[model samples]
Target: MNFFTIKTSWSNAEFILIKLCMASAYILIGSCFHDFFENHYSVLIGVFIITAIWFVYQWLKKMKSHSDIPY
Candidate 1:
């Protein structure tokens, strides 16, 4: 499976499951690094903000790719 390519064949349930798993994984990672951030709230917030931006960028790219392909 291609990590950068969003599969069009996933069912609604499968898509939702994947989303939930990703979210949980992100949260788990943040928790693991909580001490590494020195418990600084601002730094933690910045990390989450960057993550959100990355997700949005990827989503937009995926949408564009899908649009360019003829179904």
Candidate 2:
């Protein structure tokens, strides 16, 4: 399925399941890297920075695309 397509038929249970799975995956990955980092606090800070930059980048890209359309 395409990432941009809207699913009108998804139920609340399915949505919750998806969210739970994603959270589980994130925790698992973070735990895997916990041993490698000397300082756990820095890892969190780095994740925050990277996530913020990615969010801004996606927002700007979406805005640019919207601007290209004639109103």
Which candidate should be chosen as best, given TM-score against the real structure? Answer: 1
What's the C-alpha lDDT at position 12 in model 1? 69
Q: Which one wins on lDDT? A: 1
lDDT of 2 by residue, 1-71 (tens): 35465223445654554454455446546866676533465555555555556555655665566655554
Encode model 1's per-residue lDDT on 1-71: one tens digit a residue.
35566554435654553465466556657767676544565554565566666666666666677776764
Over 4 Å off, model 1: 1-38
TM, every model: 0.45, 0.43
